[model samples]
Target chain A: MDYKINVEGQTARIKLGGRLTFSHHREYRDVLNQLMSHKAQIYEFDLSGVDFIDSAGLGMLLIAKQHAEASSAEVVLKKPAEEVQRMLKVAKFEKMFNIIQ
Target chain B: MGVLANDVQLEKNQGLDSIKVKGLHNNIFVNRESVEKSESDIKNSYILVVDDLEMNRKVLGKHLTKAGFDNIEFAENGEIALQKVAESNFDILLLDIMMPGIDGFEVCQRLRSQSCYKSLPILVQTALDGDDDRSQAFAAGATDVISKPINGPELIARLHIHLENKFLVNRLTQYHDRLADELEVVQQLQQDLVPNEEQIAAIQKNLSLRLSAHFQPSSEVGGDLWAAHELSDGRLSVFLCDLTGHGVVAAVNAFRLHVLIDTLEEYILDPGCFLTELNKRLVALLPVGTFATAFHAIIDPRTEKITYAAAATHTVQIMSAENMQINILEGDGVPLGILANETYETIQIPFPYGSSLLCYSDALVEVSDSQNRNISNQTVKEWFHEAKLKKVDVVEYILNALTSCGITWLADDLTIVSVSNETE
Candidate 1:
């Protein structure tokens, strides 16, 4: 998977692409680490470019949540494709993080 | 001989102290001891020198023997060379092209024809003959060719290179064979975890249901697991779980689930509670970012309901006899081992007679057709209709349909289950 991170003051924006499965954990961790080190108050993950998310990929999001919350930051998932949105809904992501669009 | 020892030491100096050779058939790994075993490796090599003249054989054999090769054989002609090679396990062949009757080129061709000598290094001796002879020697499967009035050092160097490669390949083949044997044993154990045909037959008979399933693990063992048990309440509870990885690790996780299921019987009656407790246990069992997606359901004839709870599994498909329209049961919850306190929600639907529920792993949907079109709910309903009309097992029917549509490969384990209440 490919991702671009942009930090602007209090908010950090991430544009992730391709498949976000366990195979992409290294790249995903890099992105998380890069953004988390900024200590932004909010983190927005734009997943419109992501096509698939396996069970392990979903766990990665939880890990991301834990990392962000540890630093008192909020995470928002934005514009996920229909299938990703459906999967997140099925996994009860609403209880854990805020999803938009 | 000392020059041959430097060959392995040089390769070691390149920072590859231990070679990790994988994908030499079934992801086998072999590490060659290039550093310490270099001296013994040269001494243990078997060399065959074939020449029409005894003078040439003696000279070549003496050169090889001086260069730490103690095991040497002689062949006066190509025919004897072929015979000796067939009888003995020669590591390398030193051949003379000037030999009469089945020359070195023909010997190379004949030996190359057999699978056993496929990798044997054939070093052909030429008279600095034209490019045609050298190319012909290569075309006939000569590994390397040396010039006549052979340089002793050059012959030893060529022999050392080929022998090193041959030994590495030998180690790889040995490791691959052992891995295949071990994987076969584990694969059988994995199959044992799945409910056998006799157990399934009895369960279907007891429920008066037509049940069918299709399970195919990938080349390596995967984490897909499933079981059906007759509960004490006279209800049939079925559960399927897929761990996140493949190979031996996934197989171990499947075994762990089997152990947990065998001990946790009380929660099996209630899908939600069962999954909640399973999640709690798995959270402690699995490592971070490693989790299992699961779907558990119980068929209750008394209440005429099929209640199920799921953890990030594919949407369960249900079709009734009335309209044959596919009903989608949304499977929603965090996967097991992700959170310690996550609780699955139990969803109940009518389990009238002649109704069938189709449950499958994500591979079914993830597998796109030739047009790259994903399987949708409508497409599934159509497939279900065709299977019902043809009176074929839905699991097999859909898999066949997918195969005919050019989906001949699966990257992950696949599982499909069809359970019908046929008590009408």
Candidate 2:
């Protein structure tokens, strides 16, 4: 997926596109590591353009949230696709993160 | 020398001086193409080409060489391809779906089922163009399918895809094997913590001891553990316990049990109190669905005394010297994980010198024949009676007896610890 990082109002947003699967683990971890340098008050993830999200992608997301929480930052999910929304609900992860559907 | 080669020489002369030189250059390029094509037709790789027609094999071999693949092999029918795959590793298989003696689909399935070539990639180059054909290829484990009367570029592309995938899968298997090896090393290290039977014998002064172990893992690692520890008061502590379930998690619990016992030896001296404390700590730390059934006994050979306790384990047997007297040692309490702050009372038995205590995991008593008939315990008792009360090699004797009863596969981890009194 295409990954873009933007900073707005003390929140670091990671914009994603296309499929997120096993191949994206390294890139996803790299993105999280880069965001940690700024000491942002809030970390936002954009899944609006994501066409698919598999088990490995979900694991990456969970690890990213854990790392962000360790640094005293709040993680929020923004503008997820319909499929992404369904997966989050089924896995009961909606209650753990900010899901903007 | 040949006519075609000489015609190219005249083309070099007839053109207007310099203009003819450029045209001759173009003709040379054309001539070079045929020569290069012939060179490619001879390159070598093990390829199994299956086609009903003989001419099809010749044409396909010619084209395959042009694509830089040589060492071509031929099989007219699907059965031959399967036989060849069973014998050797063929790099690429060019299969025709419509063949006699087991069609391409069946051949693919049989090849996959063979012990040797299960991972060999098969490409279906067939005239058949239907979802049914595609599904059949997939069901039979064919890596890819290409349409017949193949476009050269498309054939090359499909070949490349399947070969690359096969290479990746083989590399992955190698990595998995290396990981399994490392895990085995770790498991052995964990197993080494338990003392062998000889070490247990050295600690006991009066009682004759025999320790036998059976570990039949449902997975790579087992959860059961047995240890013989020399306590501070000079008594030997013999412990046999089965942690819940099997595999890595259970093995981890067994390690924890070892550490807990080591720590308990330093602080708690009483067998009853030590086990009770161990039960409380384990229940608090272990995840749900994890618990242990254990029998722990402290034997003092000099005094001909043994203090014993059991937690959800079978009644232990104290065998007399004559092989006629057998006393059962039973303890009333729930298994270790069921209760906290639970007090256990120790039973003191006057174990005479030269007599032996037979303590074991449930595997010994739980053994059954092929038809699920109980044989382990009854056979052990009978074997002891027939052996003439001789002190055979302790560990070997127990293992030999267990094996003779047709009890080779212990369902759970099996361990027996025997201590002989040498003080008298």
Candidate 1: tens digits of C-alpha lDDT, residues B1-424: 1243322212333365464322212222335464245436657988888998988888888888887788998999989999999899888898898878988889998988999888888888999578988889889998877788888887776777666666766766787999999999988888888888888888877766677777777666778898888875557888988888566777788889889987778888789999999999999998766788899999876666898999977657888878777777777778898779888888788988778888887767766789988776567667887998887788889988888889988767777788887752
A1-101: candidate 2 lDDT, tens digit per residue: 78888888788988889977545767777877887777788888999998666434665676677778888888888888986775455334564577775
Candidate 2 segments whose C-alpha is farther than 4 A from its true place: A1-101, B1-118, B122-147, B151-172, B201-218, B232-234, B376-379, B384-390, B393-395, B422-424
Angstrom error at residue B330, model 2: 0.4
Per-residue CA lDDT of model 2 for B1-424, tens digit only, reads 2122212222222232321111111332223333333234324336788887798888787878887886778988877777777677687798888887688888888778876767676888788889998888888878777778876666654564455445444555787999899779757866686765466546544233333334344356677787776665566777877776556777788888888887776534466777788898887876533567778887776677888777755536676754456655564455676456666667788766666677666556555655666654445555544442564644457677666666677655666655554442
Q: For the second chain of model 2, what is the TM-score against the true structure's chain B? A: 0.64
List the pairs of residues colliding in candidate 1: none
